[model samples]
Target: MALLITDECINCDVCEPACPNEAISEGDDIYVIDPDLCTECVGHFDEPQCVVICPVDCIPHDPNHVETESDLMSKYKRITGK
Candidate 1:
């Protein structure tokens, strides 16, 4: 599943560059993850980079964008063409 940044985010600017898929961005109030591009770092790393580097623990799996490991891998391949 893609990760979501909650309202607890502090706009710390750490997660954006950590994302291998460039799914994280500055939102109006907090960082937002683009589900269409987010792969939870499936093909890029063992864990979600944004989640790993998030200081406030605001990142969480998105229930609305639920996906399996296979699904995340597929999305990663599609985005990276690898």
Candidate 2:
């Protein structure tokens, strides 16, 4: 599943660079995760890099965009064209 950044985010600007898929970006008020591009780092890392580096621990699974591990891998492949 894609991750969601809640209002608790402090905008530390760490998560944006940590996202391997480049899915995180600055929104009007906080960082937002693009579900279409988010792969939870399945193809690049053992865990989500953004989640690991976020200081506020505000990143959480996006309930509206729930997806299985296989789905994420497919997304990763599509993104990398591999």
Candidate 3:
């Protein structure tokens, strides 16, 4: 599943750079994660980098974007041009 940044985000500005997929960005009121670009860091690391670094722990699985690990890997591959 893709990760989502809830309204709890404080716009700490840390998640954007930590996303290998560049999925995180500053929204009108908070940070937001693009589901299409999110892979939960499956192909890049053991865990989601944003989740590891998020101070507010606002990042969570996007129920609307639920997908299998294979789907995540496919996304990662597409993102990296692999």
* Top-lDDT candidate index: 2
State the local distance difference test value for candidate 3.
0.94
Q: Candidate 1's residue-wise lDDT over 1-82, tens digit each? A: 8899999999999999999889998888888999999999999999999989999999999999999999999999999999
Task: Flag clash pairs in model 1.
Answer: none
Candidate 2: tens digits of C-alpha lDDT, residues 1-82: 9999999999999999998889999999999999999999999999999999999899999999999999999999999998
Of 2 and 3, the candidate ranking higher by lDDT: 2
**TM accuracy, model 3:** 0.97
- Worst lDDT window (10 residues) for model 3? 24-33
How do these models rank on lDDT, best leading? 2, 3, 1
Candidate 1's TM-score reads: 0.98
Candidate 2 vs. true structure, TM-score: 0.98
Please give, for residues 1-82, the per-residue lDDT of candidate 3 as tens digits: 9999999988889999999999988888998899999999999999999999999999989999999999999999999999
Q: What's the lDDT for residue 51 in model 1?
A: 87
Counted clashes in each candidate structure = 0, 0, 0
Backbone clash total for model 3 is 0
